[model samples]
Target: MVTTPRITPDLSTNVGALRLAFPTLMASGCYGSGEEYAPFVDLARIGGVVLKSVTRFPRLGNDAPRLVPVASGLLNAIGLQNPGIDAYLERDVAKFAERPCAVVGSVAGFSVDDYGYVTERLAARDEIDAIELNISCPNVAHEGETFACDAALAERATRAARQATTKPLIVKLSPNVTDITEIARAVEAAGGDALAVVNTVRGMAIDVERRAPMLGNVTGGLSGAAMRPIALLAVWEVAAAVRLPIVGQGGIETARDALEFLLAGASAVSIGTANFTDPRAPVAICDGLSTYLNEHGYAALRDLVGAANPTFLGTR
Candidate 1:
């Protein structure tokens, strides 16, 4: 008996109009400007890099003792430290043109106006292929994550940014909310082209010796293997609630971990804490995904999206 040759699996995907050669993206704040990892990994092999978030003004970030090691994850309170948007546009934006893959600029803000202003300036850069509106950074004080935790606020922030630029907008959502789906639906209605389901979960650590909080800020965002289940559930729920594409993140490491998110209905997967362990983790995941697809007689990565979730409403 003769068998037909299997075709190579197609891994390409799109976040709005921004085409990614692969479904792997370097999560914002995890991989500094793509330049930092070029020496350790092949930039062309991956999809893109979501640059560290920039605010309307420069920030000093949180104080010392910013990172704490936990049982299966890490807690951090980085506070979105970065040069102001003006300096970023003058000094940083130009360098992104040299990157081999897509460059997505991340914008963090304290108000709807901040989101709109920063997004307009960042998205206007020719080097920026897309925008990741970071409305859910829990590391910062009071207003940082408030936009994502409330449905109406989330919609207003998304709409403000949406009106600022035609660039593809990916709204990052918070897992700390009571009903994540409500916020996801609101963002979609507000014109978000895609959704980044589940940023790091809010957590804290204590110092028995000092009898004080481990993190200088007292509270931090938790990420790594411990949050995989939570992130997966958010992706599943959000995918079922909106038709936009979803980028699943939070605590992903191995190929199996990434696969779980795709099967649950994520159109793509963002690599964050995993990069801290291995810079080449993204390449490894792509290789593993190809092997799995061939073994299962699948023709493309999109075929696996939403495969395990019957209620999934997003497109593959």
Candidate 2:
């Protein structure tokens, strides 16, 4: 069921099928150890591997200057800590379970039975294929961004994390919204198969010579490259109000900024603070999207996903 990223830019396929390898992934708590940046690159040629939020217990996060720097990006609140959920199924489930790609597992909490006890304890493990329901933990201190800005508490925490698994859940939306399409149609009417639009944008910085606030938990979560145009205008307004499938991430670093969230509809993409400034930035964004599709003859990579929405329903 997992065929070598299905020939060029598979970025690993299967969202409902769940495989995946080429849509170029990585955003969950920003690569703490996708093989520790694999000594500078080669995370299975991009399209899978999203760990770092594991929790149902261990977490010692938040402290230090925690992180803060602006004028284009950088402000974190490192609170989802980690190392919980039975030591993340014991030290990152067998080192990303015999790697190759596709590992997604980013959970986090604050109710709904702690997101169904960490989604039935990481879906009883198979080395997780998908379950990224962080629900945007904006530096905790009161259960991340108000249960991700309402939407009926984001559809009761995405239907208690979709009755705690069968894999593939992905609901991470929370750009401190006012209406992120009412929390991405309330996690696609409480079943959520995909929607990782954004998860960092609450900001704050003021170290005016030690004059207070600059992280250390005073409010953070800015992300890089000045959050590329508000994360591509919220992945082009939630990929024209959801039909599902979107993995875009804020301030992507290249491959033409991951083809501008796949021409504003995003079926896949996430680089996050250029992996701390380009540890081979996703193999230079997969060789700059295969040289921008061999100089535009355009072929694979889902043939340019969304293909640039045309005004997406005039002035909404």
Where's the lowest-lDDT run of ten residues in candidate 1?
Answer: 136-145
Q: Which segments of candidate 2 are over 4 A away from where they belong? A: 1-21, 30-46, 53-57, 63-69, 77-80, 87-101, 105-124, 127-206, 217-223, 226-255, 259-270, 273-291, 298-316
lDDT of 2 at 220: 78
Give a tens-digit lDDT track for model 2, residues 26-116. Answer: 8887887488887777777877767887767888988878887687778999887887888678666777777677888888787767887
Say which candidate scores most in lDDT: 1
Query: 120-225 in candidate 1: lDDT tens per residue?
Result: 9999999999999999743244444588898888898899999999999999998999899999999999999999987899999999999999999999999989
* TM-score of model 1 vs. true structure: 0.96
- The candidate 2 region of ten consecutive residues with least summed lDDT is 3-12
Give lDDT per model, in order: 0.91, 0.77
CA lDDT, candidate 2, residue 147: 74
Error of 2 at 245 (Å): 26
